[model samples]
Target: HAVVDTTGAGDLYAAGVLFGLSRGAAPDHAARLGSIAAAEVISHLGARPRMDLVAVAKSILG
Candidate 1:
């Protein structure tokens, strides 16, 4: 994704990593989730998600 902003990228990454860990994902997988979340946040103008993260995760994991 094209980067528009960097605000809250770290926080979103942490959130994604924690979420993945809570769901029993492997370390690399968790980090992948974190990367995905950070990518999403940086692609837009704000820290808030513009799309459904659940859907994004499902699509990626599946």
Candidate 2:
């Protein structure tokens, strides 16, 4: 992804991993979600996501 910012990437990554674990995902799957979250955050101008993250994750993880 084209990184436009680095803010909140770590936080988003942690959040993703936690969310995945809470949803009963495996460790590697959780980490993959975390990475996807981090990548999404960094691909924009701010710490917030510009796209629908749940949909994005579903599209990717499903």
In order, candidate lDDTs are 0.84, 0.84
lDDT per residue, candidate 1, 13-51, as tens digits? 998888888888888888898898888899989889787
Clashing pairs in 1: none
- Can you write out model 2's per-residue Cα lDDT over 1-62, one digit (the tens) per residue? 57789999999999888878887788898888899889999988889977777776666557
Please give the distance, in angstroms, between residue 44's alpha carbon in candidate 1 and its true position after superposition: 1.0
User: In model 2, how large is the Cα lDDT of residue 18?
Assistant: 86
lDDT of 1: 0.84
lDDT of 2 at 53: 73
**What is the Cα-based TM-score of model 2?**
0.85
In candidate 1, what residue range of length 10 has the lowest lDDT sum?
Answer: 53-62
**Backbone collision tally, model 2:** 0
